[model samples]
Target: MKKQSIKKTPAKTPVHGSKPALARQVRIIGGEWKRTPLAVLDSEGLRPTPDRVRETVFNWLGHLLDGNWHGVHCLDLFAGTGALGFEAASRGAAQVTMIEHNTPAVRQLEATKTKLNADQVQIQRSDASTWLAKTGAGTARFNLIFLDPPYHQNWLGKVVPLCQGLLADGGLLYVESEFALTDSADSVLPEWMTGWQVLRADKAGMVFYHLLKRQ
Candidate 1:
């Protein structure tokens, strides 16, 4: 027994990928993540809603929700990191369909979805503008639709019109952009969405949130 001693084996350590996980501390400004530091993905040009803007938007729309999230569907277009949609789900939006085109952004979205356990959220990796145009005609039926496209691309013109078809009766759509809707752009909103009023327009830092009502 003294001649041969048992060998102790070292435990295996798990290794992560080449790069560490990227996360943003997103405090709920409105909806369910309110005041909570939600984990969000980060990529170049993928801007998550700032705290102040989220707070303002939520403050404006807080009354509309009225605890009616038990049966509602939401669509988040140009969903860079899927933060908005997830926030909706966390707040009780029945379902969420997230659309993001960028490869890196899409990957981050998938990662975030897993971390948040948001199985109710569906992801579609495609050009939101083209995808909506092809299948969004007269489809307005979602309880909530959000569009946060990249600046300089001018995606609002194409996406906003398409959203009218997907919004459910009296549903709300939030458009996040860098372009301010000056008097010049007022008429730019299509006549089709005449019912969708500009509920609130708030600017925080460089980001802007334009809340619309699918009247």
Candidate 2:
């Protein structure tokens, strides 16, 4: 089968629908779902992880992360519209727990969860920080965890450690940041990266992608 490309459209972008005035497609980025479209959220500026970024993140993850979809349990922090989690589900992940706080985004996520007919996904409408801390203890217990917060919040530092307890040994963590790597350890390293490989740091324009392995 031919592989489909990931496409990005602004949130609340209008499209046509038979049921009413118009509808939008959330659009899946990988697996049999590549190029698949769902509805758009009426939320403000919900960017849905750009296709290039998503593709690159997953590309590196395939090499660095241990699990290839199946048997893997994922945690998607800031899971806007359920993109990363749903993509993982489509790629064969056994389970995905998604956390998002925005009501419109959450509503869209819930809608997507139902529309995809996805059974492997668990959706939660909760604050990213609270959920990560509440979910796990300090053992590094997840196969994958995604962290992509709103750029203005400068939240990466505080939230990363909260997620550490949930990451399993040899687990992989992918962080999408709007800022470049700062000089201080306090600025970037997730408390969970205490013994993990720094792996790689790739930056493009305003976006920074860090790949870390939980040792």
Candidate 1's C-alpha runs over 4 A off are: 1-42, 182-195
How many clashes in each candidate? 6, 9
What TM-score does structure 1 among the candidates reach? 0.75
The TM-score values for the models, in the order shown, are: 0.75, 0.76
Worst 10 residues of 1 by lDDT: 182-191
How high is the lDDT of residue 96 in model 2? 93
Model 1 clashes, total count: 6
Q: Over the stretch 1-215, how does candidate 1's per-residue lDDT look in tens digits?
A: 56987899998898867986565676645554455565555556677877677666656656677767768798888777566777777778888998888887778778877866778888888888777876756754798888888788767776787777787778888988776652354546434445567778877777768888855
**Candidate 2 overall Cα lDDT vs. reference?**
0.74
What candidate 2 gets wrong by more than 4 Å, as runs, is 1-26, 38-45, 65-67, 136-140, 182-196
Quantify all predictions' global Cα lDDT against the true fold: 0.74, 0.74
TM-score leader: 2
The alpha-carbon lDDT assigned to residue 170 of candidate 2 equals 68
